[model samples]
Target: MTKNEWEQDLEQRELEKKAHNRGYRAGVKTEGEASKRVELLENVLLEFVGYDDKCLQTKPGLLKRKRADLVDQIIYQRQLMRELYNHLDDDVRLKLRTKVESHIWPVTHSED
Candidate 1:
């Protein structure tokens, strides 16, 4: 092949390399984000419900209730987080968490 043709082929290869690199980087980033999200969720669950390695060791009514409680806690926490997040400014929500410094309000309100 002529020198000009060779250079053109080299340039094309370089472009392909760069495109592949971008895609690879994006995939790595997506995988990493997913991993972190899952890890964080597990950690959060542990924090809220704690490690119950033996909770399911025995099958009865209480064990089932215990498992249900864990699910409820996760759903409750997610709901609280969602409500707090909804109140935040759009710009601040992404950069900061809604820190709960005050007492938690009752989930149900009673008529006076």
Candidate 2:
């Protein structure tokens, strides 16, 4: 490709990478909120059932279903973030240098 084309493509990729990072951050935030809600709900449910072990054997009901759904959402969000991270080039990942990425997949300096 010509220099101009290469530059334009790089710019576009940069924009996409930024957008992806923003979405990933939002997803993480949502996941945290959902986790908190799940914890609260679990505590409430346990208290409501008098902390009985038999409550765990009961059939899935409203509270249990809601908790399950939130857990599923959290898992799905994590999977999406993983997929997005995998799709990005190492150069783009380095350029973004998001805290989440830094913690999970630290990029080393490359001579390229």
Q: Over 4 Å off in model 2, which ranges?
A: 52-112
lDDT of 1 by residue, 1-112 (tens): 9999999999999999999999999999999867755754554556456567553223463355445455754676697678778998987875563222222333322221
Query: What's the number of clashes in each of the models?
Result: 0, 0
Candidate 1: which pairs clash?
Answer: none
- Model 1: lDDT to the true structure: 0.64
lDDT of 2: 0.69
My TM-score estimates for the predictions, one after another, are: 0.46, 0.44
Which residue pairs show backbone clashes in model 2? none
Worst 10 residues of 2 by lDDT: 103-112
CA RMSD, predictions in order? 14.0, 24.4
Q: Judge candidate 2 at residue 103 and give its lDDT.
A: 61
lDDT of each: 0.64, 0.69
